[model samples]
Target: MAQIAFILLCHKDPEAIISQARQLTAAGDYMAIHFDARANPADFQRIQDALNDNPNVTFAKKRIKCGWGEWSLVQASLNAVEAALDAFPRATHFYMLSGDCMAIKSAEYAHALLDGEDVDYIESFDFFESDWIKTGFKEERLIYRHYLNERKHKKLFYASFRLQERLGLKRDIPSDIQVMIGSQWWCLRRRTVEWVMDFCRERKDVMRFFRSTWIPDETFFQTIVRHVVPDTEICTSTLTFLMFTDYGMPVTFYNDHYDLLLSQDFLFARKISPEATELKQRLGELYAAKGIEFQISNEGRSLFRFLTSRGRNGVRFAPRFWEAESSLGRERELLIVVAKKWHVAKRLASKIQEVTNIQAIEYLFDEASCPMPDLGGIQTQMGKRARHRRALMRMLYEYYDTDRMVICMDPKNMEMFQDFFTDRSITRLLEVESVFTDDYLAGHAIRVGLAGENTPSQSMERLLPTIRADVLGESDRIRDAGFERYYRISELRDAQDNAFALSQFLTIPQDEALQIAQTNHLFDD
Candidate 1:
């Protein structure tokens, strides 16, 4: 078996990272870490002390300050790769990952695949997915480019013609330009790592792209691989359990879509949290009972795994009352938006009252004095805020099941309530869709006549001018030319369909027009 070196780029999360190291050790993989520059010596020593007990663990001498869009991150990754090469000369494959990431696959499975794929595995990185409009050239912002299916990278670059002048960066096509991506956290053969390092040193513009782009993490390697490598595999996506919710919070516990999480086809999971210790233990016990040994690296030693489909029968987990049907006739159609504080909640409540004309009965619970449920009864703590939230959600579902009685909040807080709801059926609860940031809403508005007819045309018309402005204003040192091509060439075909036409641009669909007119009391023109 080829030895594997798993490297974690750790920051202030020393405890979490250290735990991960221990987990890695259990899985029979070697571990290494590069602490962020901001990490305290004491914190670093704490992690060091823990890992010092293990002969296999290697801690780096220097720290890296990874800039989001700069070469710092790429350099840091390279540093780890170099260290792994030197420390574990016998290790044939090196897997790079972040402190926030977790492995979902058993070590045997991952190592087996890496051993077979004598080549490098980096995940795909398209230009549009990179944060171009949000952080590229200041004045050139192409927001619609992402949605356009057929646009080419060249078209986008030409669109942002002004980028060259602003950044003084020139794009010249060399005879050799490679592209490849697999897992962002990938298993690289020794030669592939060395080849990558040499290629980066030789490519000046590539380095410049890494230095100037908003997020060069994926793009740098992807662009280079496509240019040089013969056969590379796009490995895994980065979205994992942590991206599903605002986890790692200090006070409250959140329930995530655990079933969905286990369903991912990927072998490794990113951003596994330490806070889910209880859940992890349960998973481990379940797996052990089934005679399947779940393993983790040193940092992730305490992680748990169970048979994916048996959650319902194996455990008597309580579903959130709001997420469940009300036993009493009073099921409140309340929307609770979670926020940082009560004032923000109050302000949001006022906005909902104004827009939907629904008044929410506000209540407060302090965390310090909150009563947690005991075996037979809930021990009454008088003032915990989370309890108040639980009590309020329960009341809404129990006492107020009416048309006007609805709850609304930002998507952030809705995630927190994920623990309370298990029945995903639409008929069970009122789901107040957010008008903000939901493109589906915009699409539905046109389909249902709530938005003006010719909305699609108007949306494109509104969109095209912005595209022109962004193109004429930015730098060309973007992730790739793919985004430019995708937006410019591809969208024209989509624009031809009537069904695809936005409501603001043309006459609405008859079925939808009627629904909109009826809902808003607008007469047919």
Candidate 2:
């Protein structure tokens, strides 16, 4: 068996780190950990105590105070690698990991995989080629110097940096080394580690240059490997699964991601935070099912106990109303009215009821809005529009148990009521609109179309095809007729008289014009 040295740069979640260490420890595999100097002393000691009996596990003597986007992370990684190499001279492979990361595959499996492969597994791309650099603030990270830890004089530093940029005073990277950036996590061979260490030692200027740069850890290893190793010898995969939110923060995995994790062929996964105790429990169960032993620390167990207790008592607990049983019976069908004003919603709801004889609920977007029942004092930390829409959808699901067709539209576009109900039943209406102009129509249309298809007792895959065809056909017609610009009815309200004005713009028939006029009537009054 090939000896693999695992160098872990850990900060938070000591219990998780210890658990990972235990999992990676084996006869030929050695684990070297470098806990951040900023970590709690108690937590560090707990990890030490847990792994004291394991001879394969060791710790870096010179711990560094690692920070995000700082050079210290690179330094800590070097320290851990040096410690591992010194402790395990016969080791053939080196794997770098973080505290938040855990192995998805067994140590034996990992050894076998590495033994069969000759190339290094490191995700890398040319700095200039990546879209992130193109779309994101390029100069701030690449050209200008960022003093991430210099909090007290940050404003002064930023001002000076901007001044320098304006004056065209920019630092240049060493000509010999081309810039490459990638995920910090990587697996390499023993020869590669020696080569990197030697390169760093020989080129102090390169190290100095990277020290002043942002997120050096992401670039330092990648740049060196790309310069030294041939492209054929480098596999462009980190073999670790990491998920991030739209805002770029790492997403903590939960029970919801259980099947997703199983489906992936990654060796390790990251960012299973303390709040994800349930996820950890589920992972343990999954591993057990695969005939692999997984364990959680006492600290993790205690934290989960406290959280579950609080949840049971309804303290800081927000129930997903969408997943709950509906108090409204099957006899009563819901009418969701999406409007900006209460008066408009009320008028539209009354008008719809008069025309179709269906009882409806009005959901107003602006000032005169009424709160949904059973959701008092529950706060969602999402953006205003997303929170409101989520709450509305939850209420709709709770009240209507059946997987029936739903129609979503704006109260402002109440004129569409005649054309909308002319074909569909009144009970199928889910009146809602997007505050965002771009997704207003398409988002609601898809939501209503998918509403009852996923009900507990239904397996109608055919419904989605029909719904999709209808939506796509309408979209194509609007695009072909040059009415795509008028899709956002609210924006059109300011320029046009009524929905019929759209008919004039597109030069459609009178019946369609009348239909548009009816939907655009709220703005007319």
Candidate 3:
């Protein structure tokens, strides 16, 4: 049977770790615990007892304290991996997951996933940006000082090492190699695991390099494997949710976003936060009602699927909503744009005005609120923000209310303002209605071409030119204002309007578009 090995670096969160172990064990996956060296023996004993008699559970080596900029953490994780491989020699694929990562896919599906692919699961790490290299340190004192100054004391003990600053070693640092970030957790085939272990065991220089590096957990296995197997299939993104709240921090899954993990694909979700127990229970109910399950495929591969749900089939777009207007019916209007101080929203607004002949007002919220908490004084904050939103939303509707055709760049603050406006007439802006991500306005447009409802007979391709023009026009002004470069707005616009265009932009197919849109909530549910 294919198996997932849940590994945990123990700390203050014993309850969290044990709970996760229980969940994974219940789901018929293997569990392994590597208690941090600093943890009291009593605590480890408690963990052992909690995980007792679980056929899949294994207590691995005691872990040494590891610092952020050091390699000890990597060594500890590698130890757990070694133990898991030895204990479950029969498991075809070895899954390395964290105690924090709940299992969301069924055991059968996870097994199937392991059985399906022929390649090693992790991605190439050598292409990461060079900036990540600066994080590694070798000296205990310098490492301590850096962490102390950075207020990251929790990671101090394990990382600080005497060999970090060896000058000869510094000369040996590979310039061609780049550091990449990944889940401290991942899965791999048995052969790949054995290969990685053997490679590390034989390379003395590689062992030396691991001693002084920062975030060695990220680079150790990933970089080592890249040298031998140049084309492994790394799970650089989530297999489930796009984003999730973990311990109150928002983790997103996007360009190089590997932190937002999923517990499973079909039935369960990782606990968003320890505080969200109620929410998690509610989520479980939601999953049960949906009839998702894991089973062996006809090909005898373990795979998870949903019986109640089928994928969607269209281009889905998410738009940012406008902020709420305090002066919904106010007569006098203001059109102040708000954004980061350096964002240059004012210049963009000016260019839009130049093209459309509409006057724009600009405000720097950062400057307005400066000396902010530092200056204890009058409280006009709420009033100031409300004033800006009310003024801008009011002006946005002015042309619409009067039946005038016009376009204006929202003050950067209004970047999220599209969803809040209530007027149905305001929905005519094809861009806003189709692409908003805010909760204020009517939810995302579901302009499916139902036979009876208003549907476009012209394929999404036919409408692409107009959409491209509008987006390109807007982005040009934004770029002229000194914003960073991206794909030409024309390219992005077509990707946004037509599903087929999006498939081209992403280089995926039409069927994939529906899957992406549904999974990402890019279209209305």
Candidate 4:
């Protein structure tokens, strides 16, 4: 078995840290602890005393007064790594972790997984290409030098920084180095760790540049490692499960997150708090029941057996959809646009509001010939025939706060879409008729719909083919996509004719329909 070293950064809760160290302790393993210099010396001594009997446990001599979003945190981790390698010459791999982290997998499983791989498991993304830079706040953290500890003059400091940036006085990163960012926690081979340290030592300017950058701890190691290590030798996952709040802060894991944690294929989970003592105890019991031992004699043999057995079962647990659903809170209204003839739009809207009890609005593509009375729960909007349908969609989204919308060719098709609004339905359709604009937009909104009981897996099997029939002539493409599960409901099939009927009734020229369909990319493959 390859000797593994864990470099853990701890600042609080000595008891929890000790428990974590004990759980991970085994032969051919080393645990190096780095207590933050700001933490009480008495507490640090208590941790050291508790682990004094274990020869594998050691503490770093250089402790850093670490602060969030600061370089000191990186310094502390580097110190722990140095100590681990110096203390355990036999160590082959090193894992960086925080005190709040707990191992979800057994040490044997971890060793087996790592031993089979010769790559560094660190999540890294090019800074310029990352969504945080592309879609989120851009260059806010990079352009200005950050002093994380200067809280007293924060507003004035930022104001001055902004002034400097507006004047084109931005800080420049080294031309030789490319900035990369990732999760602070990572597991890497000893060689990669040594290379990163050496790179930082040789490039003092790069180190100095990162010291003033915001959240440098996330970028410093990843940038150095990605630059030094070959791309083939890097695995783009940190192998750590972290639950973050909407604001991007790691939330404390409690009893409620137990199933969520278990569903992930990660070895460790972080930010578990003292309040989660009961949860930790329960998890320990579950691990014991699963027969995951702390140590194994044959290297990689037990892990290979466990993995093969699991593969034979062919069952993978997906995170409960309700977890994401609950986070989204309330379900948004679905906007349906229907044909203007025979008051079909109003009737369909009223029926949907009555049956599903969901807030829905109907938009008439053509100007209403007469004043339509509001049907209490259902709302109506009329658009000029010359106006593009996408304009109406934008107006609905802007004025009504409608989160999801669908355009229908006819009102008779409304019954066929009732399942779309049903709580038991998947809410989003992977494939829909090309005429249906906002398919992706609606899918995103509904993907995080309100939380309740989960829909049965068979419900998706029944829903897709029924909707497929109404989608014109894409049957071959749909079937080839493996969506042909033969759920024949006559109501769904009959609705397919409504599009043609409404075309005739509205006297909509064939040329106009063809043009609209072409513009919407609704043509069958």
- Candidate 4, residue 256: Cα displacement in angstroms equals 4.5
lDDT (CA) per prediction: 0.46, 0.60, 0.45, 0.59
The model with the greatest lDDT is 2
Name the 10 consecutive residues with the lowest summed lDDT in model 4.
483-492
Q: Write model 4 residue lDDT over 1-525, tens digit each, in one string.
A: 666789999899888888777767743468999999999999998998999999888888799998876778888988898888788888888988888887766666677888888999998889878764433434666767777554546687567777877898787778988888889889989899889888878988888788788777778888899999999999988888775544556767787555445545677888677788787876654432444533211112222232234223223344335422322113433333333122334444344344334344443443354333343312244433212233333354455454543333343332223323343212322222223333322332223231112322233233234333333323333334332121111122234443343233223455443332222212322
> lDDT tens string, model 1, 351-412?
44544455454322323332233312322443333434454444444444443333323222
lDDT of 2 at 24: 65
The Cα RMSD of model 4 versus the native structure comes to: 16.1
In candidate 3, which residue ranges exceed 4 Å CA deviation? 127-169, 174-181, 238-271, 279-525
lDDT string for model 2 (104-195, tens) is 65565566778898988898788877754535445456666766654546677578777878998788888888888888889999999999
Give the lDDT of residue 308 in candidate 4. Answer: 35
- lDDT per residue for candidate 3 within 129-197, as digits (tens), equals 433233334333212222221236545533433233443223345554444444444566777778888
| Candidate order by decreasing lDDT | 2, 4, 1, 3
Q: Which ten residues in a row have the lowest lDDT in candidate 2?
A: 294-303
**Residue 288, candidate 2: alpha-carbon lDDT:** 24
lDDT of 3 at 338: 28
